[model samples]
Target: MTSTFPILTPAGVRRILLDRKEIALIDVREEDPFAQSHPLWAANFPLSKLELDAWPRIPRRDTPVVVYGEHDGVDLAPRAAQVLRALGYTSVHLLEGGLAGWIAAGGETFRDVNVASKSFGELVESKRHTPSLSAQEVQVLLDAHADAVVVDARRFDEYQTMSIPTATNVPGAELVLRVRELAPDPATRVIVNCAGRTRSIIGAQSLVNAGLPNPVAALRNGTIGWTLAGQKLDRGASRRAPADVTAINRARAQSGARDIAAKAGVRRIAYAELASLDAPGRTVYRFDVRTPDEFAAGHFPGFVSAPGGQLVQETDHNAPVRGARIVLADDDGVRADMSASWLAQMGWEVWVVDPVDAGLRSETGTVGHPAPEAEAVATITPGTLAGWLNDPKENDVAVLDVTASANYVKRHIPGAWFVIRAQLQQALEKIPSARRYVLTCGTSQLARFAAADLKRLTQAEVAVLEGGTQAWIEAKLPLEEGETRLAVPRSDRYRRPYEGTDNATEAMQAYLDWEFGLIAQLERDGTHFFNVV
Candidate 1:
């Protein structure tokens, strides 16, 4: 069954993503490895969390899914296909030759998460010549305590972790909507920044696109640039965006956003009109573009929570079906209006749904989707398993820790074999024989998914650790570290040279150099319709 699966070439997959069609090009390896190298638009769908995530990530069972993995003697695409099929996915296939084949076919590969967003940021800068200031220049403004407001466009937590001295926390989506309030005096210069380039560029440009009067510029390369420039960074800063925007400023932003959106041919849809627009032969994606906290406070039903800033930055991740119609909802029209403008220019048929109407609304957790049911797999808790380990003669349990290689190396249950969830069939040969096989991961979701594979491949009783390794830690059990024993190679993960504490200066510069070249790649591909107002 594995060998008989149909294959998709690298060139074919590239065209699919470039065309913005409904096909999901999935990288089945763990996230860290996928970050090292992969096609520009490919989404990481690790085999570890397939069952728990597949249903929600790829809702339509029949949506074309193409899975691939590391080609270094560890091919997981076939095994991933089996799991997808078991979950009732009608159309599933493999990427021919895997990562190597994609490289061979001359497809553009990018490192790091949110490649599409970063590439778009580069494109926006290339086309619009969005204003920017180097780390040195921004530092000068701050030192002088000039009439300038440095707005960190990253999440509040990231801002608190490390930030440019005296930057306020107005995230990307909120910038245009509340900038006037942040800098009521039009003369106050607004400088936007992120951990790196993408959000900074997008945030600064968002204000420009919205036609803000304040002088705006992105911190040349953000915190990374700031550190590299030998500037001091503030830690544990608690600055936040303005408490409220003035009424006049709100009306101006809403009015300006409407004009910008109109230029992209974006439509304004009433709450009731949403039903009529859900026509046959069209996939309608409903999204609420507000703060994660606000969305959890109160939001309409049947809509996924995608912040406006993140939705635009990771459009392919949020809406893989490129041509699908997208409807964005928000309490204030500014976020929805501003976000829809970007989506429209990106070639989506976009609309804004008024969120003021009282509809069937749900407010609870941050996540929109429910966990998938794994009825076939039995479960055991960390404490019960600890008691079983205490039994001397009845010790017949063989554990397979299917967590990421990095996590496994740090700590794991004593005598557990670290294995990839997809490679369980072959991994069975390497582990010790036992009366029962147990599976585990960071959160136990992957363990549950792997449990089904263990049951199918062997007659031994297979059970998943209920809360996984985290539960074990909380249970106060001892853990063993290092790669002393393993059923799988550590090839599933790729150590990023540009990340971590000890990165060499040249490598950081090289990373930035590569990002600088993405604009040319976009020019060569001619697919991204990045229109700047």
Candidate 2:
């Protein structure tokens, strides 16, 4: 039976990309499989998370979207397209032949996530010859107590997990503004590093671009390189940049960042321009590029928080839609300008929102957009579920957790079985039948959809945990840890070689080799509109 939804060839998608139009090339498979191989610009929008993620990720209903997926002979693309249509998305199409079709058409595929931004980082280094110091050289400097400071450009949590000796955490966006405080002397050498190469290169180049007086360099290949060079990394280190920036340093940083942003062709937009950019056909993403705590304190009404450093490191995950217009906001002048400079160079039509009255940032607390609603599903409070679980014989119930597999392994209800929502029916075949079933995830939102799905698959009674696993923990309920019972394989997240202390030497070297070759890959692909200023 041939399908009814409109079909797009790999060539058609490429044409749209070349034309610089808005097109979402979505891979509707779990991240593990999608990370194995995907077209250069394809964003993973798993079928299991389609309803929960679609609205926020692809906000414009009529934006051209091409979905493709296949796992264990299960064709998920058509199903994903249908779900998009039901969510009020008017322009949804399936990629002809899916991943296989793209390969057959000679389309370039990339391994690992965020290849677009990672490759761009390599391109930036190639074009600019970004300065860097090998782990061994940096180690020599540290051993000699030279006039140098190592700034880890990753998130604080990553720094805490593993860091270079005598390194301080000053995430990428803060490098230009905070480096002065970290190394007060203009002659001090500043070394920036991350788990791997991208953030390290970008962080170092940012200072160079800002024309910082200090001599700066990235730690070549970051911690991975350190490990490869037989150097030890410090664990549980909490060194950080000072909280306060000197007025003079702040002024210099602001001027420098703005100059670089202008060089990269980033526009400074007034708040009123947001409405025009967000007009019907256009998809505009408004983001607050400050720290998470700063964003939680206050933010623009329509903007969500995306820390500037992580935003650049994970542009594909943050924006997804190629060619979408992005507006970044920050109370301080430097962060947003610095972040926008990189986005502009990445070929996005990016703008930094001009400073507004403090009164405009009145919204308090972290941004958490609830997934769009589906038909009402019955709900059970965490307390009520606890009572039922205490004596299961009479209650005759089964609990299914639909959260990420990794999260499920960390903590979950004492006896709930981990299951993939997309494989719910197949998983049902393995679980013993029960009179009643309860579903849960990180929040009850995803579980609510899963409950509705379960109701259709069986005649059994179905309900969602009122507040999901978080609420269960808050209720002081007993919890189980580790992969207790799994009805489906854990294929949700792809483990990156750059993460954690335990990884094969071979894998780390392979990851580095892959990144080393990305500049050539970018040229062969030819869709990236990157320009290094």
Candidate 3:
């Protein structure tokens, strides 16, 4: 049966991209499968967590949203469309014939997470000719204990996970701000690395753009290249950049950041001008480029926490609104100014707000917008659901665990059917008859999205389990293991060959080859307006 939502051909979507129209090309498949192949502009909008992620990812409900799935019998695009319509999305359509149609229409597809930004990073390096030192050369420098410091541009946890010997956790945004403290002497060399190529390249180029006195270079290919070359990585290392940034260093960072930002054409907006950016119907993302700890200590109200380095590395994950205006804020002006430089080069209309006003709030803790309200649905407590399971009167009560198949196989309520939330209606036909159905997931947030769908499909008394599987575990409940009761296969999360040390050498090499080929793909697509100073 054809969907009432019009079918958008791949050529039509391609034209939209070429014409630079605002579009949300959404792929409703799980991340892993979607990573294997997708249009360059398509963002993953998995069916399972549509309610939670869609509002922020696709801000304008009326934005042209073209959704696609595998086109197999189990495709989730149709179900996803229903959910989007329910969520009040005004304009929604499906990609005709799904991903296959895109390939058939000569649309370029990309692999790996954040492919767009990764390719752009490669372009930046190619254009600016970022400097780098290979693993062998870096090892020689480390052996000699030269006047050089290696800065891990990744998050602290990743540095803790694995790092080069004597590397400090400067993160990405901190590099430009704290480099003077780490390597005070102008002659000291600075080296930066991430798990892979992008952060290292960006970090090195940042200092070059800032006109820092020290010689800077990215550790070629980052940790992956090091491991491939048989260099030993230190695990559980916890060295951090110096805590107190000197006043002289602060002034230097600010001056340098301002100069670089000016060259990149980044903007600065005062609080009053920011008011217009906040008016309704405009898509503006405010980010505090400070560290999580700093933001928690005090930050402007309504700003999301996106530490500078990680924001540059994970632009797709943090800000999916490509054409949306972005405003970055920081107290010292160094962090936000430096970060805004990169974002501006990446084609974002970015602004840096000098955050010295009385409006800065000291609300200490994690900050985020309140989640959009979910539809009204009946729910049962974990303890109550347990009682219902044991009751003789309700012996026919059935459980549908809407978590990923991988999680289900790890631990699940005994006799619970592992299902994809959006596929609940189709799965119900094959499930055993029940007087009532209880839906659950890791936290039950996604279960709410499935509750109405289940009720509509089964017409049976459907209710979500409060607190989900986690709440059940807290109740000292027993769990079943194995892949015995599954309505959905585990295909959501991609297992990157480059991520862990356990992958076969061939697979890792293949991953590197794929990354190397992205430059050509970018040329073929030719839409990303990436510039490097």
- Evaluate all candidate structures by whole-model CA lDDT and list the values in order: 0.81, 0.92, 0.83
lDDT for 83 (candidate 2):
88
Identify the leading candidate in terms of TM-score: 2
What local lDDT does model 3 show for residue 309? 84
Which pairs in model 1 have colliding backbones?
A: none
Q: What's the C-alpha lDDT at position 5 in model 3? A: 88
Ranking by TM-score: 2, 3, 1
Q: How accurate is candidate 2 locally (lDDT)?
A: 0.92
Over 4 Å off, model 3? 1-3, 6-9, 278-282, 362-364, 368-375, 387-399, 404-418, 425-436, 457-461, 473-487
Give the per-residue lDDT digits (tens) of candidate 1, residues 1-533: 56767888877777776666767788888777788888766788777677767776676677788888864486878877988898888778788888888888877677877777788788778788999999999988888999999999887877887888989988888988888987989899999998778889988988987889999999988877887898888888898987688889988888878888898788888887888876754567889899988888778877878989889877867876545788999888899998898888777889998656544455545764656666667889888888888789659988899988889999999988999876776688888789988889998877876787678788888898888999999999989999967897775675443334455767667667878988777676555666655
For 1-533, candidate 2 gives per-residue lDDT tens digits of 22768899999999999999999999999999999999999999989989988888888889999999999899988878888888988888889899999999999999999999999999999999999999999999999999999999999999999999999999888888888988888999999999899999999999999989899999999999999999999999999999899999999999999999999999988976777777767789999988899898999998998999999999988899998999999987999999999999999999899988888899999877646786799999999899888975646888999999989999999889999998899889888888989999998888988888889899989999998999999989999999898998888889899999999999999999999999888888999999999
Model 3, 1-533: lDDT tens digits are: 34578888988887776665666788888888888888777788788788888876676677778888863467678878877887888788888888888888778899888887788788888988899999899999999989999999989998887898889999889988888888999999999998778889889988988789999999988888888889999989989988789888998888899999999999988865787775544468888889999888887777779999888877777776566678998888788888999888888889888556755554567865434576789999988888988888879899999887778889999889988776666577778888899999999987887887777777689899999999999998989999878776666678877565566767767777887788999889776777777
Best prediction by lDDT: 2
How well does candidate 1 match the true structure in TM-score terms? 0.88
